[model samples]
Target chain A: MRASLKSFTPLILFLGLVVLLAFGLKTDPRKVPSPLVGKPAPRFSLPALQDPNRTVSNADLAGKLSLVNVWASWCVSCRAEHAELMRLSREEEDLQILGLNWKDDVVAATRMLRVYGDPYRVSAFDPDNQVGIHWGVYGAPETFVVDFEGTIRYKHIGPIDRTVWEQDLLPLIQAIRKTTNGHE
Target chain B: MNTNPAAPLVSVICEIFNRILIPIAPLRAILLTALLAVSTASAYTLEAFAFEDPAQAAAFRELIEELRCLVCQNESLAGSQAELAQDLREEVYRRFRAGEGRDEIVDFLVARYGDFVLYDPPLKPSTYLLWFGPFLLITVSTFFLIRTLLHKRQSPDSALSPREHEQLRELLDPHGSDRDGRNGPDQDKSDRER
Candidate 1:
């Protein structure tokens, strides 16, 4: 029995290595877990994208479950996610979708919103990317789920389609809503 | 040597180097220009933030060097030109100008971007494997290797037994004395013919 176990040692080690490597290969290296989750959302005050005269801030998102989406007109994936956002806006009345227009030309951003459809309840224009840096936004189309208390509940990197909305975001939102209602 | 398939190609290369390449003034000038361009390009200036105190400037330089650029994973904040990297550099500069200490600034970035923002990851429970994995592997491999060597040393002797030795002697020298009269392997054919 001792010899048999000894003989299988190499095979066992190889299998362990294979499993570890397979898991690593399946994971996306670009998706770094945000430390901002479970913490209060970063403070920011920027002019609204549609109306430059009006300002939007985190205070506006208070007392509502918010979806803060980091997007740019130049980002192709955001364009892909735009229709979904519109659909989500129409569907979920309680869920506030706040757009963060990051490091983009104002004219182009406005044009894209006009051409497609503006899904955001209020879009904050971050032309200098000062607010984006504070929010730890590395790429475009990153979505953050903020609870009614303005605490970031979850951060989803990459574009959100229907599958992502259903599989990941929807469940998390439901869970947060349940807990918040229970507390209330 | 002349029949070698690669001989002609080698000779052509040698001929080109001796004649066209070595004597070409414009080619040399172009190569010199390229070298100068690379050297000048490599000399980067951190002119965006200027501090009155040289120590503060040095600190700023050191801090950015230690910070990792998220967009380009392998590059330091000082070297990266990606939009996010630029924004991060500006943020670091802003923090320095605000009179925040290096540790405070690092903590601020770590809070936002996680520990990935720092080139040197902190010693923590999650990073224990990363910090000590090499030493553990070395210790394990050394233990196994020593055990193998000691086990090999303790193995039974491989010398032939007395009975086997006797059998080998008999096979080599069947006839104990005057073995010349015996039919040798090559001489067996001659003996058969006779």
Candidate 2:
């Protein structure tokens, strides 16, 4: 009996490892937690997408609740979320939506905005992706919710669908607004 | 089936051909193909960067491999063909050219993208499990294994009482013990007389 139990030890260890690996396999490795959450959003100044001569910066986004979306003309996922963004822009009057046009040609971005309907209050062109790097943008269509103090409150990695907007983002925004209004 | 002098030689040749050369032929082909694949796979174009010194260039290459491509997830910045990886490589290059050290560049990336941007995550409270979980499992397993081995070795020698030992002896040699018991004193007397 003792020998049998002793021999089963390896089998037990193997099973434990199998279980751990199975759990790991079920997880999506791309959904990495961002460090910028709860930290001050990186400051940047760039040429506006509409008019290259005009500039927009992070200073303009301060003292108001804002959603900064990083997107590019080449990104397919950005198109998927564009309609939702347009709807949100129309519905939510108090929330300011800013655009970081990541590594896109100005002409293409301008054309895309004109065709798709511009939801951004001001779209900043990041021709070299410098501002995108500062914002920790690895992929297009990443969105961040910034609070009144310019701190990044929440981040959404992929295309923001109706479910994600309703379940996660909407409640958080409401709660933040409540606290900020209470203080005021 | 031929009983000739040269038949054994012919059979030996056939055996060598069938058993050795036939099997090795496919294996050699596979090895050659694998070698070709590996050689072609490593044929990558050299990335152009103006470095102040060879050491800086080496550091730049090392840092690129150390950083993870967030978009690709599985590939390092050096190996990835993703646009984000290209941008990150450019960013690292620019930073290095501007006199930023390896640690400073890594810190800058970590600040923005978090430790996920690093291929090798630093040891901290949150990542302690990632770093040491396997060691912890090994230690626990080793403890249990040693305990079980020690118990198995010591149990037979120390666990039996004298009564239990007697019972075991009786069970093993019951007939031999009965004969010895009957002839014990007689055999001793006979041996003494001799």
Candidate 3:
């Protein structure tokens, strides 16, 4: 009984430590809840990267299908999902792609644009994240597809991969473009 | 066709009661559901509870936010609607409104409940790990973190200096002493420190 009692002590302590470690450690996702779904996209008029005079807002792209991709140069997932954005540009002529860059300096974002083949028609800068917060974004690399009427149709979190493009994103664009939303 | 004043009067009264009472019942039900939903949206209080005064009720709500619902170890009392959290919130409110000072309330809880009552406890030698473990763990992890990350470092010796590692380890085990390592002191120092 004494020997068995001695052997059981180590197992108990090991189990105890494992429980303590698991309970103590806390991980933060640093993500915001998706708020734009089933609502109108927040309106903004940001100057285009190259064409400083040309400002794009929610109103400018009304009555046309637009894809707004929220990304940052620092986001690893954005790098992972860049190729798919390029693919979307190739396949869909009517689906205009816009980049809403969050918290990224011009130089780094410009570098990312160069590397990723600039699928964005125009990239907007969100320094100090005021625009991002107004849009209610936590971390970057989120995507929203707005219909011609300025109502948001879909939100894609993380990267725009092949499966999502086929399953959800493509179907939404095909349906929204059919709506009577043509702005000359 | 013979007109009857008595029959017409009875029918008019029936119609009047239906118009008033039937609509009001549905309206009351709708209002009741709306109130429940709004209350449920902040459902971290867990249980149906009440305080003696408005002040105790408000403070209890804040205190619950700080406490970890034991059932949902990751969630605070304010963030969880678990039954245990509900019961705990009620307990906290009961004590707070009863004119107990903060320390007395907490001590009574600690005496019966153990160290899980407070979200952040005092930093004694015994609870040093609990209070400072996050920072220490982050620091030690930072060193190993830097090493794993900086395999591209200029010098191998620059893989977090020994002093840095010791400090990191000390931080990780906030309640640790030289005599006993890792978890709060073993039997020898547990008595002395705790």
Candidate 4:
């Protein structure tokens, strides 16, 4: 009886490991929580994608709720999320949506914008990805929600969909706006 | 052939040649092809970083390998061909060239990307399970194994009572031919005679 129980110990341990791994599998590895959440967003200045002579900086995003989306013309997910972003721009008139065009040819980025319809108030061209590095961007199709004080409140790491917009992002934006309006 | 003076030496040499070199020839060919395949596969263009100091360049290489690529979780920053990995490598090289210490550079990445960027996470409250979990399992298993062995050692001598021993003797000597009832000196002779 004792021998049988002793042999069963290994099976128990194996089952425990299986359960832990099963739980781990449910989590998306791509959605690792960013360290920049709740911290002030990084500052940067870059030439506008449409006009190289004109530039935009972090200062323009102050005193408003903003969405800073990191995207590239080559990123397929960016195209997938572009329509949602355009709809969001139309829906949220007060929300300032900015774009950081990461590591793409200027001509290609401009062409993509022309075809897809620009949703950003100002899309900053980041050919060298210097500003992207400062923003701690790992890849394209990442979005950050910055509060009125320019603090990054939330970060979405993949293509945004309607469900994500309604469930996670829109509620948070509304809450922040309510608090900011109360203070005013 | 047996009478030949050099027959034994020739046979020994043939045996050694057959045992060793015959098998190794094909294995060597396979290894050569594998090496060629690997070299050609990894010949894709990569961004290069120049450093004024060779030591700094070596440090940069080490640091990049130690950092994990967030986009490609399984690959190191140095090994990944992802664009983000390239940009990170560039960032590390830039920082190393700017006179940042290895710890400083790693800390900067950790601050921005969090501990996930590190292949080897630092020991802390949050990472205690990751760092010490294997050792904990080993220690627990060792404890149980030692306890089981100790219990087994004690059971044979102390756990068996006199009545149980008598029953065990009866079970072993089922024939019960001897009047002494125990397996004595006569029992061996009886078995040998049979």
**Residue range with the least summed lDDT across 10 consecutive positions in model 4 chain A:** A131-140
| Model 4 per-residue lDDT tens digits across residues B56-151 | 778788888899999889999988877778778878877887888999989888878889999888999988999899999899989988998998
Candidate 1: C-alpha lDDT: 0.91
Best by DockQ: 1
- lDDT for A42 (candidate 4): 87
Which run of 10 residues does model 1 chain A get worst, by summed lDDT?
Answer: A127-136
True lDDT of residue B50, candidate 2: 68
Two-chain complex of model 2, DockQ on C-alpha atoms against the true structure: 0.59
| DockQ ranking from best candidate downward | 1, 2, 4, 3
The stretch of ten residues in a row with the least summed lDDT in candidate 2 chain A is A27-36
Q: Write one digit per residue (lDDT tens) for candidate 4, span A78-112.
A: 99999999999999999989999988999899999
Model 4, position B46: C-alpha lDDT score: 35
Candidate 2's clash total is: 0
What TM-score describes the B chain of model 1? 0.63
Interface RMSD of each: 0.7, 0.9, 17.0, 1.0
Query: Of the candidates numbered 1 and 4, which has the greater DockQ value?
Result: 1
Q: Candidate 1 lDDT, tens digit per residue, B86-166?
A: 888888898899999999999989999999989999999999999999999999999999999998899956889999997
TM-score of each: 0.79, 0.72, 0.41, 0.72
Candidate 4 stretches with Cα past 4 Å from truth are: A1-16, B1-47, B145-194
Q: Is the docking of candidate 4 incorrect, acceptable, medium or high quality?
A: acceptable
Q: Which stretch of 10 consecutive residues in model 2 chain B shows the poorest summed lDDT?
A: B174-183
Q: Local error of candidate 3 at A184, Å?
A: 14
Question: Candidate 4: lDDT of A154?
Answer: 95
